[model samples]
Target chain A: MKKLINKPEDFVRESLAGMAVAHRDLIKVNYEPTFVYRADAPLQGKVAIISGGGSGHEPMHSGFVGQGMLDAACPGEVFTSPTPDQMLAAAQQVDGGAGILYIIKNYSGDLMNFEMAVELAHLEGIRAVNILVDDDVAVKDSLYTQGRRGVGTTVLAEKICGAAADQGYDLHQLADLCRRVNQNGRSMGMALSSCTVPAKGTPTFALANDEIELGIGIHGEPGRNRISLKSGDEITELLAQTIINDTEYRRTVREWSEVKEKWVDLELLNKPLQKGDRLLAFVNSMGGTPIAELYLVYRKLAEICELEGLQIVRNLIGPYITSLDMQGCSITLLKLDDEMLRLWDAPVKTPSLRWGV
Target chain B: MKKLINKPEDFVRESLAGMAVAHRDLIKVNYEPTFVYRADAPLQGKVAIISGGGSGHEPMHSGFVGQGMLDAACPGEVFTSPTPDQMLAAAQQVDGGAGILYIIKNYSGDLMNFEMAVELAHLEGIRAVNILVDDDVAVKDSLYTQGRRGVGTTVLAEKICGAAADQGYDLHQLADLCRRVNQNGRSMGMALSSCTVPAKGTPTFALANDEIELGIGIHGEPGRNRISLKSGDEITELLAQTIINDTEYRRTVREWSEVKEKWVDLELLNKPLQKGDRLLAFVNSMGGTPIAELYLVYRKLAEICELEGLQIVRNLIGPYITSLDMQGCSITLLKLDDEMLRLWDAPVKTPSLRWGV
Candidate 1:
């Protein structure tokens, strides 16, 4: 394992400075030993959207803070959440009269730090809303932990919610939309190789060349199971089936009639989808999966949907969100209604995710 | 080298199927032996933008198609150009009443196939224009070969030109803009480790743990020289200085009066740049260089720009474009005028590059 760096400790700070200089018009750095927002941000009105996480996922929280998506992003050390103080400063800088929305992923450290920032913001009388994205289906739904971890779905949520916010949807509406995307979407990933964190300077995990870990987390966490490499068609079927089974898309349709019969007053229960409800699918490369391979997965997924008579309204296939450089991909499905489709089609201009102007 | 695939022959076809399934709305496979575009394309009257290249560079041609960027993308096998037939089919399918613009990255196979597609489209009476992107500074300019194989600058050409097309620029104007971006921008790359193309299943080049290859191409092509790995700061300086020296930015400014006198008929030549001109900078990952590392490179670039008194108006940092999984990054700088800045600020909505909506 080889790298180009002066010292491990100087990586994040030096990198941020470089970004500020390179994208002077789009971004600026505060340079006080904290990851702060640039003074110039897009759109002075509406609520400000702020997100931050580890540093390895470039263009994620930081690269995404431009015209359409996040107003400010505080990148922490590689794979480590930013300190609450850093978040507080970002919130202070970007927060206008319209308040702020904190788009947080559900990692333990991320949640805790963002929560502390929210509390601190509240103390300052600056209104804030927190939307925790827990879209990964790899983790089991449990009482002990906070459901599943957030992975690729964060990108979609940020773009969608960013569009809504840019369109003058109040902070509450933006937060609700963010939560809705997180709730409606689910992602499951596998890893053929573990990524080497720059500081560590070696592979994070070792595996035989032929084996792949399924249901892998972004931080190189162990997946649910290890399986031998398979055909693209076979892998697509496995991942798609897992996502469909884990999601409420299929099960909820069947339960719709039963719930309607049990309760007439439940308005939501009566709107049962009678097959052919449209969906938005995303096949994301974890980190190291080639775009070609991701597209291949998308092709097979489309075949499955066609066979099953599901109407895929829209589809996104690429490395929208990623682990460091995990050599695998994840499948994400967002069962869309007409409203979600309209929102999805709305124009967004961010450093990362953008679609439909 | 580890990868997830059953066999090499089935890679491209299987991947195409997966893309169609995952993004059924945005894309659909023709399902004939050849990959074709979805029937519902180019909504109507919107100028079609098409691009294609080798497959390994995921998101290059395919991931970029959507509303604002490419209308259709034809990806070939790993690191191989798509056949002429495929490009012709893609051109026909994506073309609207507004004619088509083919954005060709300056690789031998890419250039040839795209040229053939242009001829085929012309034979069909569909208007077509070609904008060749040749921005890499590593390769010397020559009339015998397409001067300097287009590298990281293709992303800027696609994006800036995409924004122009999205704004309803005529095909000729779009072609000119793409050409201008390619002319104004210059990039040079360095790699730490050679990437393993999925089809090859082996490292493209062998390098010891401490070695680095400079002036590398996106497809794991051999670089100019191999040397001991240096500090990130030193690497950044080496690459940036190389690009700066290769570009005609300062020399053009110095020879502005002479060039203007000689080429008075040319509008662009008549309007030579002054000292206060702004620039757009990009530090792109080869494939595997993390965002953190890329940003570190950007810092050194900023120092150089400051010393040279260059006003960087906008900076894009990250792996917007990439090699398969090459562990390296490249830096790009685009000198900007007011018009270029406005165009850069224009809104774009593509699957890959999106900003200023």
Candidate 2:
């Protein structure tokens, strides 16, 4: 395990500390119950957006904290979920008078902890709600998720919702916009190699020299199947086709109804992508893969998108969300509407993502 | 070696093809001679800035091509410097009415080829000059360089010089500004593991599980020493201290003399960094190192800078310059004056580096 780190246990805090200092102009870090918040947080009358997850997937939840993205991000230990207290503290720190919204990935740990956080926030008289993201079409049930593990779409959802929030959307409007983005997005990932967790001092999993794990999850979770290695074009087509051909996905999620003022379980379904839909295509490196290779994947992916009659109006290619130092990539395709496209193009200033001021 | 590539030979072209498509709004990829130029090239009166090197160091030359950075970038095969023709073609394609400046790294092939390209460009009736970067303090001479090799400082120079050109700095002025930046900067790198080039299916160099190569070159060239792997802080201190304590370096480099209408060798010297100097500290990943790990390194780097009485005015941490998928990082510190700081803060809209706009 040749990682540039100190003690494994200190990895998360130290990295966060470094981030806080480096981006001190943009973000502020709070330790103990570790969470990162926008340096100029708590914009009055603006809904605060918060998200949390495991530590290994960097620049995801924490690096996204800043203007036009996330208000705060709670980080757990490596590949471990943050406790509800951390989320609660983040919400408290960043919540403006408008309200709070938690963008929770649909993993068991994240779901449960964020739900608890919502309840705790409500108990403290804060109007808080939850919007779940489960855009990974590669699995129905995985090691850490019940329906689908939230993958690449979480990044899209954050960007779109962050823009909406910046544009003065209320809590309910932000929730609906986030839900719409999640429903319209699909992702599939494949692993060229497994990532080593610093504490473990070994790779989470292994593959032969000439093999790959298709449809893999972010935390090295087993995907649909392991297969022999193939060309870049072949692998890209496989992942893209799986996402494009997915019929529909239905899942029951808990949501906070302001009218009812209580948590309610609602069954939601995502319609399959159709021809002529415009997309915001994202090709993300899984840590160890180079940006040059992501461009290769993007080349083939753009070809596939064209052949499938999907117009890729916007695209993002790089290591926005990564799994430690794993060598792989994930593709996220989000069907875009006029409003979504406008928000996606809006200004965002985060540590990991920035454009248009 | 598990990489997301098709044919080994097609790796560079395909990746560029992907980059061209993914960032078509920002850049255009030309084939055969193989150079990436800004979509809005020939800025009419602004001096065009061109750079090139091996293909593996992505987002260096090509990805930096956009509105406020590089005007064009020529890429060679993996770990190989570009030819004179590629550079000449790029100069012809992007040369504005003002002139052209080629930001060449201090590698033998790059220096030789770019020198030849300048002659060819002059023969074609286009005014062109060169600015050489040799900021790497790792070794006096290495596998591919005659003096200090250009490492992380190349990125800083391109950005600063690109902004200077955007603000209408003429050819000679841009050359002097670039020389000032290169002279004021220093860098050192370390590698945790080796990266595999596509054609060369084996690792560039091997490192024991419990060892690390300090002062490593971008192309996995042998460094000053290999020792037992240490904690991230210790390693960061080693790299930072080496750069901080480097003595004045003297080298003779070739530069075009517009007045003399010839290329001439000039001996240059760079003084060591002093206390109370303002710096733009850049911590870059060598492809595979995670951004999280870089923050850990940054934490220690920041501490060392304070102890040495240097003030960091700005910072950039990510994989801006890479060596394929090698797990390592490099640190670059550029002393900034009022003009350089202003230009450094200017809007830059590239595929990899974007800020202020």
Candidate 3:
């Protein structure tokens, strides 16, 4: 693949420098023996939010750092987590008297690095809270594996929590809200083609042009299954069904517990939803899916939602989170209550995701 | 070429429905009859900004509407501009007492459609100002044809203009600023591979894996020239040099006129740039370029900028505006003055683009 880079190892550092240069007022890069954050940050009282992962997700962690989303984002090497020290610097730079919230995606490396950063922050007398986002429904949970992988849900969590923090929600409230959003949201992705990592200089995995891997991860991780290319409607149905099955299963288990209690006050939990209960559906491109294709997925999703008697109150259909250039997409559904809906309606401004207040 | 769509025609309607359902609080779809704006627009006296174009550029126009960016966005059929009627309705719906600014990309179809909408708005007694974004430097200006086609520059235009509007810049100033940003900025694009428009379900053009087309339009239009794929550094050098050359050429011509009149204000023409004159550089993914590869491009760009004595104040490197899934990127540089930098520093809240308050 033809690329416009110098030494592959210098890509991230040089790119961050250029980003600092281009957005000097909004961002500054700390280039020394290690990458750290500059001193100037946004509102001081507001609890700072920090998130990072592999550098390949450009707008994910970095693009989101600004007034309303993240206070700082530490990007590691391409598709690799930042070192613990980097996260510690990010935490120190953004941490105010209030505190800092670490929004860690459920990748093993990211989790470990962020966890270590939290420890470092504690050592520095900074109060740091960790919120792990594990919203992907593609993976099965077992004692043996690392639970479901966090995918598109991280964006939603960051935006929602960012708004909460902006609204002066306490650190506990912000952490709780982040956890709730992650719990309520579910995502599943598919890949039509393998994305070539820059260093690898080739496709991460080989797939015939006609074949697709369902439930793929952002790092080109193998999905649960492989299948022939399906129609847009079929693809939506396949993904929606998987998500619905997972979510419904969880709901059913929760409801069964309520039923066993036989408490009359459980009416709110047991009350059947009316036609207008809100839902936020995100039809996200996994890098290579076109807007046209994404909208097609939205169309099928609408049909499925209508048939299933689910009221989709809010829908975002685009490439919010991506998987390099994997050529497929994921569907994320966030069931919303009145409060969550209001938060979703609140205005936000960030580099990549924006809406409401 | 298996797709998830039922039929090509149903894509837009279905997607709109899904969007309304997913983001009910933020957006609504007047499906079947027309593409109308949601009644829940946030600002009251703010002049509504409406923009749209072909649907393949997923988040370009529609994904931008909310909070600080756009009031309404009309989505056209794949790779085709929306009709005047759709834009007119969007204009009317977003018009909050104040006039409306139509941020139109400089495509023949988009320009014509938006122009018709402006006339329609005038007929309806609605004040409408049109700002044409013609920042692409690839297309040579000639009396025989329309000027350069708008490419990635539209994103920055919408953003800066959006911030201006959000901060209560009058409609005239907003429109003027939009034009100023467009005038000050230039973008040139290249594509390593032609993207597959979902409706077409085939690559727009075929090229060997090692080949690239320079000056490619966002909608899979033929580029100014094609070239063999080279190293990332070479590609960055080619693109950055083109942009720098254009800027320098314009500077020289202006200087020549000043010298001839003996009214040469070198300070005004060649403003003494400080060590930290803010510059915003965007290494935009045409569509399919991976974030890793995009960063590689940014790295080389930083090196070149340092060599050229340009202080990049800020940088955005990602797929902000895209060309479906074309595997390439474009670079945009906006030299920022003190006032411009302050405006850039001002906080903004939008759906797709966000920065300082």
lDDT of 2 by residue, A1-357 (tens): 898899999999999989999998899999877899999998999999999999999989899999899999999999998999999888889989788989998888999999899999999888999999998998864334588889999999999999999999999999999999999999999999999999999999989999999999999998899999999999999999999999878888889888899999888899999999999999999999999999999999999999999999999998988899999999999999999999999999999999988
lDDT of 1 by residue, B1-357 (tens): 555455787776776655555554555565332543534685577678777787767557666666556677777788888877877777677777788888788787887777777777777877777666777777754444445777777777776776677778877677678767767888888998888877677888898988999888888777678888999988888887787766342211111112132212222221222355577888877666666676777778878877777777787766667787777888888877676778777765444556544
Judged by lDDT, which candidate is best?
2
| Range of the 10 consecutive residues with the lowest summed lDDT in candidate 1 chain A | A250-259
**Residue range with the least summed lDDT across 10 consecutive positions in model 2 chain A:** A138-147
TM-score of every prediction relative to native: 0.80, 0.99, 0.77
Looking at chain B only, the TM-scores across the models are: 0.87, 0.98, 0.87
Q: Grade the docking of candidate 1.
A: acceptable
On DockQ, who's better, 2 or 3? 2
Candidate with maximal DockQ: 2
Model 1: lDDT equals: 0.71
User: For residues B1-357, could you state the per-residue lDDT of candidate 2 as single tens digits?
Assistant: 889999999999999999988888899999989999999997899999999999899988899999789999999999899999999899889988788999988888888999999999999999999989999898864334489988898999999999999998989899999999999999999999998989989998989999999989999999999999999999999999999999888888889999999989888898999999999999999999999999999999999999999999999999988999999999999999999999999999999999988
The CA lDDT of each predicted structure is 0.71, 0.92, 0.71
Q: Which ten residues in a row have the lowest lDDT in candidate 2 chain B?
A: B138-147
Note the residue pairs that clash in candidate 2. Answer: none
